[model samples]
Target: MNILIVYAHPEPNSLNGFLKDLAVETLSAAGHEVIVSDLYEKNFKAVADRNDFTELNNPEKLNYIQEQYHASKNRTFTSDILEEQDHLLWADIAIFQFPIWWTESPAILKGWFDRVLAYNFAYGPGHYDQGNLRGKKAMLSITHGASSLANYGAYGLKGDLDERLFNIQHEKLFFCGMDVIEPFIFHSSTKEDAKEGLFNDYRKKLLNISNEPVIPFHPLSHYEKGQLKDQYKTSIQQELEMS
Candidate 1:
């Protein structure tokens, strides 16, 4: 299987970087071809603006979505964005590796989402389970500063980590029609105690990732008027406001 690891973190010596490096070697040893888009090393343009499109449908106004849709049909997206899009299409799965900053992915990853998952290509009205990237798989590999306190649910100092990741997992990954697997995270990855055990776990998980199940995101037909039918809500979604 082909895999793409979209990594974000400025420092090569950072925990996020080390994991990304390990992923390349580990996944490759498992017989998977791997590609890494090191955002910082590439100096990837993190901001999405008019520069994204080589030609514009409406030069007078900056209608981002409309431009994206137009670019999708015209192949007018710049080389950088096009490269990332090509990497996505070529890969069987994409793993996003980053630290949870402000309860979300780093700004560069957000930019990657915005620019690569363009309208008419990644998503549209008939998206969700039916989007263009339908058959692919996606997963998150994140680290955070908080310790076990993050797992304390609503009472946790950081709130529920699962809940906090709902937007990224459900809204973004699932929205793109990929079968998103449950995220693999290393809490307090920066701490000395968390390093060895967590790194070993990550290596083991990658070797067996092919057996992982997709997260239970019901298909579009399961929705009515753009809302999930109540019966479709899983205990996790019902107990915690995942949507």
Candidate 2:
């Protein structure tokens, strides 16, 4: 399998960095062709602006989506954006390795999404499960500062980790039609023992990625006119008989 690991962490000696290394080594040893995009090391840009395009669709006004759509159609994306997109296209599996910051991925990684997942390529009309990246697989290899219990259940301080990551798993990867794997999340990874445990678990997960169960996302067929089909309503919605 062709794999791409988009790694985001400043310190090479950090826990996230170590996991990134482990992923490359383990996957390569398993006979997969692996590529790592160390965002910080590459000094990737995190903000989206006119710089992404070589030509403007409308010089009088700046609409990023419009410009991106035009650029994508005309093959005018900047060199950096094109390079990342090329890597994305070459990979069968994409693993995002990052430490959660302020409840989401770091700015650089987020920016990578903004620029690389271009208009008409990643999403537009008939997108989400029908997007250009269909048939691919994606997973989040994440690290969190809080303990597992703190991020669990109704009473947990951080609520549900799944809920927190819904945007990335459901909106981003699923929208692009990639089978989203259940994330490998390590909590309170500051300790030595925790690091060891995380390493072991991650190695196992990487080796079994092809067989991992994908997260269940409602198919496009489950919606009509932007509303979920009647048979697909949640229990709360069913009880309330929401119209």
| lDDT values, one for every candidate | 0.87, 0.87
Model 1, C-alpha of 209: deviation from truth (Å): 1.5
Q: Where does candidate 1 have its weakest 10-residue lDDT segment?
A: 233-242
TM-score of each: 0.92, 0.92
Model 1 segments more than 4 A misplaced: 189-194, 234-243
- TM for candidate 2 is 0.92
lDDT of 1 by residue, 36-116 (tens): 999989998889999999999999999999999999999999999999999999989999999999999989989999999
Provide the RMSD of all predictions against the true structure, rounded to 1 decimal: 3.3, 4.0
lDDT of 2 by residue, 101-148 (tens): 988999999999999988787777657778779999999999888855
